[model samples]
Target: MNERPSRHVIRPSGCPGLLRVVQALDGGICRIKLDGGSIQADQAEAVALVAERFAGGVIEATNRANLQVRGIGPERDALIESLLAAGLGPRNPAGDDVRNLMLSPSAGIDRRMLIDTRPLAEQILTTLQTHERFHELSAKFAVQLDGAEALAMLEHHHDLWLSALVRDGEPWLAFGFAGVPLDEPAGRVPLAQGHALVVAVLELFLDLARPDQNRMRELLAEFSADEFVTLLARRVPLQPCPDWRRVASTDGLHIGIHPQHDDGVFVGAVVPLGRLDAAMLRGAARLAREKGDGSLRFTPWQSLLLPNVRADNAAGVLARLQALGLLVSGDQPLAQLIACTGSSGCAKAMADTKADAHQLAERLHRRGQALNIHLSGCPRSCAAAHIAPATLLAVAPGRYDLYFRDATLPGFGALQAHNLTIEALDHWLDAHPRSPLDA
Candidate 1:
């Protein structure tokens, strides 16, 4: 706690970052941000070692497709040092917090990509970090770059989102403010101008926004999008985009074996409740080095993908990942479950979310059900960036209130049942067997 990243930095947050460690009920949590959710095999092992040695070995694959080390006691400094040694820290110390850029896990390797967004993403990330003026931005003020990858996460909302599009059969990137690619794009720019567009938008945001207007949406709340866009145009050129919508991709692309554009395959797996032990990660790292192309990619679904594996060895690699306690197959009930850190970790938790989620997974598994289910510790659905089809909001230690997703209703959709035990939830789930909450 003494080694604060910045003097102006806010006091102990539940939100973890590389330079800062957020304290929880369990201990301090340190988040390690990956470049496009891609890390080398050795880096994965480093995370495993530090998590197991200095912390509680509870490594979480975050919804942002990053890694978080949870349950750190007084040895926080050592853990941080290990991660830094592994080259996981930000480029500059002051730039650490604002380094929030999300790229598709399959950015360059995906067969359906229009452009490889990695180079542009790198430029943006460097600018976000080194630009001292941008340091004032909130850690949650994220920007997503989509390369039109078939395996992309389009549902997560961000302060600024840029998605690749083809205009007149030429590659262009369409951008929107405070929305996802799935939403209509406000404007478009040539692929070459993508980085400049991001820079202009961010600089304009910093210049015009007040202290209270930390996010783009907040600034847009008072100032019209056109007004903001005009100010942005003063810095860089932007073309008006029509009513083109982003093509939706398949759900559950983060599980099992997947094809890559290159001459190989990538095996994906999920961590139960987004938490994993050192052994599991280390085993994955070994598989990545042995069978894959020595790199692993994490996804926004709180899952891990071992990319660049030979297609011939993919089955064995997946089998190895499964043997290491990873949920490789999509049919597993646990694979469909996403849960936040509950009473065992976060002080605000109403239930032991991990334990309760395990019970739910077991019950649903017995009933042969598989749905996108999110189990929040409390009202804050931190485990998921987007609302899942079904949610169980914890009300007590082991009781929950269930809700189904209804686009018409706000906040986790409409409430279905109140104060139901795990067993009762099982029965309710069984009764609604035909619901896609199972599909």
Candidate 2:
């Protein structure tokens, strides 16, 4: 047998990686960060097999478009070895934690994409993993490369964000920091300089940020964005883009069959509460192999997309996915709900968020309403990277405080009701059917 590459020592962090399994209430968790969430069919099957053999068969599709195996046993090393053999490990061991780049699951295939982000994403990802200096970045420090795809996750804020644009009939990338692409860009760079811009921004951040300031927002709080951008200009050419703003992405495009830029179509399905079993994964992999391209792309919506499918085969693929116990329709109440690993898995949780979300879904479904709601076990908001239209924060077992998303307010928006049970919350929603909170 070939010897495995020696694991490099990484900075201390609470987050899990393929080489670092963090203990949770359920067991250990090992996160497998995919390049733009793309996973080959056979590689996915290997993941399923290892999850069943070494963990509790619980595989979760994270909000960051990554997968994690929960309830791992003492055979953690074996599980890691299996995944590594399947080519899921980082290019370099130390690169694992810093591989926090997000791309639209429909990056290359989206009909509305301005440019194919895969090539640029590849360059950035390689630099992130192989560049030794970048290893000092916080595990949560992330970057987003937007191709202006209709199905992009534009709400999730990142340390740095780049969105493709066209200026004077030439391709350019509008860039910003400490926000999403929807925000007005601080500057623009030529398309060919996208990779250089990313490298310069990261290097500048590392140089200026204090040891205590690990995130871009933290550094910006001390050093103004204008000041940072001024220094960045010295590293790379920057063009003012004061009037440039990214277009809003269409919601629910991540859930049904969507047409690609080419003749092929992509079928998407929601993984209930972001949790999947070994069987569900294996089945999806098989379908990907048979009906679509031999790969699956997970999404920031905690869903998976089977891309490159023939238009005629899209419906059948969707149906097969549904048979695997995945939610293929937006009307499914669970498809609109997201929950964290509550008391059932996380020690910090005050309640079993997953079970409560299920109960809430049933109530909403019976009422013929499918609203986008997030159920968080605690203030950490592990389930959602972006604020949902409505948030239910747990205060005690079966009780939560409801908040409505108000652009004017911060941190889960304005809190509306405090400590209401799942049943009472259902009643509250029923009472306010016409309110914006209905979303």
Candidate 3:
């Protein structure tokens, strides 16, 4: 940990953190950010213990590859202290909210990855926390580092994204602002200058943006991205990324057995509807310690991967995960469903989305149809950072409006029905069986 130290100044944010517990309908919630989504077995165990002891034992796997403990009670200070003792806190209090860097769950081990990404990610993360200027970034402002992994989450939006690529046998990083790596890169830089590029981009953003423009997208709405890039070029050398587009890889690799770059395999399982009780998390941690590399990597897909597991033990690991109430296969109905902290937790929720998601899962299970679905308690869509193939937006306690993802449409996409019950939605799915909702 050869990182520079920064001053501690608590920034005000509505988002929950290990130190800042935001109150919900259920109780208080504290988010514990993981460095590139990687957590050790002992750290996982410690989180489980604190959740059970100080909170309500309800642990949520966030869409950003982080974890949050819900229903935290009066022992909030104790919970925070316990987590800080486990080395889960940021280097300084001001660094906590700005440490929002995302990497593929299979970052270092993905067989298809062009670069390992861990080393650069380490440097970037250290700077994000230790550099005081970056502390002014909005809690939601994020950055993504792509190693061209086959199992990457390419759809999620980030303020800045850097992806690995090669040009004439030399490695370079294709970068973009206010969008994902899947979009055409704004520019490119030598691999060695990636860190410098990020610093320059952030500093330039801070210099040009007004106080109200906390996000890159917000600032870009008023200022041209081209102009911003021009200013950034003065700080860091850049090159044009001509006619380069990231290749879309296969999906659903976040579940079940997947081979790593090494001979070992990674066992992945979805935390059913993004909710994990203490027992479930502890069980997964125990399995990681016993059968894997004594570590677990949480994915942006609301799933966890036990990396470096022996290929021979893949089946056993999958079975054990299933026994722990995790959805181990892509075909599992629960695996395809994601719900926000609905009425049962969040005060802003219009319906109990988690409970309804279970009902929808039961209906789909009977029909043997598995589709990627998202149930949001409101339009805020806290559960899904990106648009899902199908979305059930709650209008009332048990009624919802359904939307299918359409590339041409915005928001939730094309609305198909309004104020339909779960049963009615099931029947509608049966009617339009060939809809793009399967995506």
In angstroms, the error of model 1 at 4 is: 3.8
Candidate 2 shows a clash count of 0
Give one digit per residue, the lDDT tens place, for model 3 in 1-439: 1111232345567888777888888988899999999999999999999999989999999999999999888887788888988999998787899999999999999999999999999999999989999988899999999999899998999999999998889889999988898898989998899999999999898899899998999999989988988888899988898899998866989998989998899999999999999999999999999999899999999999999999999999999999999998888888999999899998889999999999999998998888788999999999999998889999999999999888898899999999999999888877886777643
The C-alpha TM-scores of every prediction are: 0.96, 0.97, 0.97
Highest lDDT against the true fold, candidate: 2
Residue 124, candidate 1: Cα error in Å is 0.7
Q: In candidate 2, what are the lDDT values of residues 196-264, reduced to their tens digit?
A: 999999999999989999899999988999999899999999999978878899989888898999989
Candidate 1 residue spans exceeding 4 A from truth: 1-14, 434-439
Off by over 4 Å in 3: 1-9
